[model samples]
Target: MTLLAFLLGLALGIGFWLWQRQRLQRQLKQMLGVLQTDASSTAMSVVSRLRQEIAQANEHRSQLEERLQTWRRLLEVAPLGYLQVDEENRLLCCNDQARHLLQIDRWEPRQLRLLLELVRSYELDQLIEQTRHQQKPTIQEWVFHPPCLDGEAMGEVRSLTLRASSWPLPHGHVGVFLENRQPLIELAQSRNQWFSDLAHELRTPLTSIRLVAEALQGRLENPARRWVEQLLHETNRLINLIQNWLELSNLEKNPSKSLTYQSLELRSLIQSAWQTLEPLAQQKQMCLAYVGPDTLWIRADEARLTQVFLNLFDNSIKHSHRQGTIRVEVTAREAQVLDSEGTVDSPPFSNASDQPDSDASPSLIQIDMIDTGSGFADSDLPHVFKRLYRGDPSRQKSQGTSEPFTLVGSSGSGLGLSIIQQIIQAHGGTVQARNHPETGGAWLQIKLPDHKNLS
Candidate 1:
C-alpha cells in the first residue's frame, strides 16, 4: 500500500507539468499571429501613401512642362526683337529676332554690354541715359551702312529707327523690345529732296519775267500802251507765283526758321505797311485808318512779320470798294476769349522784355479790314487760305470797278492768305478770316504771342 501511494503521487506531478506546458505553447502561438497581422497592416498603409504622392508629383511636372514649351514657342516666333538682360545690362537671353537684328550668336551675358561700347553717336548715348535714369522707354534712330548684296557689294547707308521699352522683372531682370523703322525715314528724306528741287525750277521763270518787264518800260508809245500793260501785268503774276513757291519751300525746310529777332514799335510797322498800301487804297477811293495806340511794341523778325501784316492789308484794299474805310485797332484780350475764338492775338512788337503778358495783361493788336464791297460767303471762310481759291469768281472775272484793276485769274494766285498763314505760324502766331458783323465784309485777323514772351 505504501509503494502504490508513491507511484500515484509521481504520476500526478507529471500530469500537472504537461498541462502547464500545453497552455504556454498555445499562448505563444496566439501572440505570434497578432504581431504578424499588425506588421502587414502598417506596411500596406505606407505603400498606398507613397503611390498617391508619386502620381500627384507626375501631374504637376506635366503642367509645368506644357507652360514652359508655350513660352519658348512665343519667344521664337515673335516678330520684333525680344531680349532679357540682368540688372547690369548684360544679356541674359534673346529671341530669334533679337539675335538676327543685333548679330548675336552663342549669346554671352558680356556681349550685349560690349556692343553698346561701340556706339559712337551722341543720340544713342542720350537714349540710353534716358532709359536708365528716367526708367522710361525711349525711341531713337540711327543710320548704318550695312553690308549688301549677299555681303558682296558695299551697302548704302540706311536709317534704322529703334524703339526700346524696358520693364523691371523678377530677379532684377529687364526686358527690351526693338522694332525697325527704316521705311519712314526713307520717305521723309525723299520728300525733302523733292521740295528742294522744285524751288530751283520755279525761280528761273521769275527772273526772266522781271528782266523783260524792266526792259520794256518807257519803250512803249501810246498806241502800244495796252499791250505793254498786259505784258507787265502777266509778268508780275508769274513773279508772284515764283515767290509763293519759294516761300512754301522755305516753310517745308524749317517751319520755325526765321531771322534773328529785332525790337520794334507795333504802330511804326503798321504805319509803314499802311503807307505802302496807301496808293492802292486811294485808287479805290478807300480811307485807310489806324485806330490803335502809337506806343505798342513787339519782338519779331521785322521783315517777315511786316510781310504778314502787309499781305492782309493788301487783300483788304484789293477786295474793298472805292471810298471804303479800312480800320486798324490794337487792344488787349483774355486768354480764354482768344482760345474760344480759335486764334491768338498778335504779339506786341518790341524786344522780348517789352511784350505783353498774355495771361495777366490784356494787350492785343487787331487790324480790321472793313470794306463797303460785297462780303465773302461764310462757307468760303475756312478755305480762304487754300491755293487758287476764288470768291465771287464771276465778279472777279469782270475786273475791278473804278480802279480798272484786274480782279481775277492770275492777279491773286489764291496763295496770298496761305503764305500769310504760314509766316504767322512760323512766328508762333495765328490768323483767322471771318465776315465783319458791322460792315458785313470779309475780315482777316492776326494773333501772336506777346512781345515779352517772344523768345
Candidate 2:
C-alpha cells in the first residue's frame, strides 16, 4: 500500500513539472515576439522621419535657387554696369552691361579668374583695393580705354569716362557699379568749342563796325548827333561784350597762359580799382572803406587782378543804394586750414593751377568785398557765374524801396562775375558769392595765393 501511494505522488509531481515547463516556454516566446515587433516599428519610424526631412531640404534648396535666378535676371537688365569679385579679387559674376563696358569677352558665369587678368585697368584695380582696404563705399572716375573686341590695338579706340562706386561685401568680396559719362563729357566739350569759335569769328566784324560808328560820330547834329553818339555807345558796348567773351574763353582754354605773374601791393590795387570806379560810385553817393593790413603783397597777373576788382566794384556801384558804403576786408590764412573747407567739383572755374601744390606758398590773401545792395537771390546764387546769366531785377533796384540804380552802365554785359572767377582760379585761388552776414548785402569773397604776408 505504501509503494502504490508513492508512485501516485511521483506521477502527479512529474505531470505538474511538465505543465510548468510548457507555460514558461510560451511566455518566453510571447515576450520575444513583442520586442521584435516594437524594434521593427521604431526603425521604420526613424527611416520615414529621415526621408521627410530630406524632401524638405530639397524643397528649400529649390526655393533658394529660384530666388537667386530672379535676382540675377533683374540685375542682368539693369542699365548701369554691375560686377562682383571674390575675396581673391577673382571675377565672380557680372551683368551684360559690365561685360560691354569692361570688354570682358573671355569669361562666362561660374568661372573665376583674377580681375587684373581679365581687364587691364589700373584705375579699376586701385579702386577695388581702396574699397577693400577702407571697407567702405568709395567713388572714383577714370578714363577707360576698352579693349578691341576685333583683336585690334586698344589705343586706336577712343576712351570713355567711367565712374565707379564700390562697396565691400561679406568675406572680402566687393561689388562695383559703373557709369559711362563719355557722352555728357563730349557734349559739354563740343558746346564750349562752338561758342569759342563763334566768339572768335565775331571779333573781326565787330571791330569794323566800331570803326565805322566812330567815323560817323563827328558828322551829325541834335537828335541825329545823339543817335550817332548812341550808335557809337552801343557799338562800343557790343565790342566790349565780344572782348569779354573772348577773354573768358581764352582763360578757360589756358588759364595759366593768360597770366603774367607779378608782385604788387594788394591795398594799392584795391585803391586803384576804387579810383577807376570812383566816378560811378560818386553818382550813387557810395564810399569805399578798406579794413585790413595797410600793406600786403601777392603774386598774380596785374591786368587780370585789376579786372577782378574793377568788375566787383562796378557791380557794387551799379547796385548799391544811395549813401551806401562798400567795405573791403582782408586777412591772411594758412593754405591747410582754408583747404579743410574743401572745394566744389564744378566750381565757377576749373584749372590745373586750382589744385594746391606742396611747393606753393602757405599764405593766401583773402578779400571780402561787401556792399549795401540787394543781395543775390537764393535761386540765382549758383547760376550767377554762368556767362550771360540774367541778373535779378532786385539787383537793379533794392527791395523795399522805389528808387532805381541809375549810376551804372546799361544792365551790364553779365560777363563781369564770370571773368572775376576765371581771374581768381588762374591765380591758383578761389572765389565765392554770398550775402554778408553783418553787412546785409551782396558779398564777394576772393582768395589769392600770396607769396608774402604780414601775418
Candidate 3:
C-alpha cells in the first residue's frame, strides 16, 4: 500500500509542472506579438511624415524656379545692355545687347572671364577697377573704331555710353546697366551746331557793315548821305543775318531737302580756303600754312566745308600774336594689332563704312588747326562753342583798347567756333577743341568721312 501511494504522488507532480510550462510559453508569444505591432505603427508614422516634408520642399523649389525665370526673362529682353558681374570681374549673366557690344557669342559664365582677359583698353579696365574698388556707379563713353573685314576693310565707328552701378544683393550679386549714345550725340550735335553757326553768320555781315559805316562817317561829310549810308549798311547786315536764320529754319523743316554731297580733294579745299583768307592773313602779318595730304578727299558740301575752314583760319589769324605760325596738319589713323602675332588690316577712319579696303568703306579726313596763341581758360573750354559765349569776360571789356585792323574785330562777336562746329556737323562730321598736346595752344580738329585711299 505505501509504495503505490508514492508512485501516484510523483505522477501528479510531474503533470502539474508540464501544464505550467505550456502556459508560460503561450504568454511569452502574446507579449512578442504586441511588441511587433507597436514597432510597425511607429515606422509607418515616421514614413508618412517624411513624405509630407519632401512634398513641401518640392513645392518651394518650384516657386523659386518660377521667380528666377521671370527675372531672367526681364534681364534678357531689355533694350539696354544688361550685365551682372561679381567682384572678381567674373560675368554671371549678360543680355543680348551686351554680347553685341562686346562682340561676343555664346555667352557663358566663362565669357566674363574671357572678356576681362581680352578687354585690354585702359579706359575699360579703369571702369572695371573703379566699379570693384569703389563700389559705386560709374558713367563712361566708349568709342569703337575697329578695322574692317579681316583687316582688309575699315570698321564702323560706334560710340557707347555706359552707366554701371553695383550694390550688395540679397544673395551677393552685382548688377550693371548700359545705354546707347549715338542718338544723344547726334541730337546734341544738331542743337549746338545750329545755334553756333547762326551766331557766326550774323557776326560776319555785322562786322563788315560796321567797318564800312565807320569809314563812311569820316569820309562822307554830308549828313543825309552819312546817315542814309549807315542806315543802309546796318539794315543789310540785319537782313543778311535774318535771311541766314530763315534758311536754317527751312532746312530743319524739310530735312529731305538734301544739300549737294560730292567728293572733293582736301588739298584743293585747303588751297582755296588759304587763298580766300590770304589777304587777311597778310594784313595781320601771320603765317598760315596747309600741312595736309595732297590726295586726300572728303565727301561733303563744298560751300559748307569752305565756311568751316574760313572760320577756323580767320579765328587763328585773329587770335594769334603778330608773326605767329599757324599749322594745319592731317592724320590718317591705322588700326593697331590686338596681340603680338595678330595683324589687323590697313588704317581706320579714312573710309566710309568703318571698314578698310571695302568698296563701301569711306576713309576719314581729319584737319587740325593749331595756332601758337593764347589758349582758352580751362573753365571756358566746355562752353567755347556755345552761341554768344565770349571768352574771358575781362577780355571782352578790354576791347576798349582800340587797335586797328581787327578784321575779326575783338573776338569777332564770339560766334566763330560755334559756326565752325555747325558747318562741320552738317557734313556728318565732328569737331573738338583742346590745348595742343605738344604746343600748348588752341588746337581745333575737324574729322569728316572720306572716300579716298588712306594708304
lDDT of each: 0.64, 0.79, 0.62
Model 3 lDDT per residue over 99-133, tens place: 76656554565455634653334555566666666
True-vs-predicted CA distance for residue 244, candidate 3, Å? 4.7
List the candidate 3 regions with Cα displacement exceeding 4 Å: 1-137, 140-221, 243-258, 335-362, 393-415, 437-440, 452-455
Models sorted by TM-score, best on top: 2, 1, 3
Deviation from native of the Cα of residue 208 in model 1, angstroms: 3.5
Model 2 worst lDDT run, 10 consecutive residues:
402-411
Those runs of model 1 whose alpha carbons end farther than 4 Å from true positions after fitting are: 1-196, 209-229, 334-369, 395-411
Give the per-residue Cα lDDT of candidate 2 at 14. Answer: 99
- Candidate 1 similarity to native, TM-score: 0.49
lDDT of 2 by residue, 155-210 (tens): 57788899999999999999999999989998977887897788788879878987
User: Where in model 2 is the C-alpha error above 4 Å?
Assistant: 1-77, 83-160, 165-175, 335-361, 392-398, 402-411, 450-455
Residue range 130-215, candidate 1, lDDT tens digits: 56666656565655333343644345434466555555565555566767666666686687567557757766876787677667
* Candidate 3 positional error at 223, Å: 3.5
Per-prediction TM-score: 0.49, 0.69, 0.48
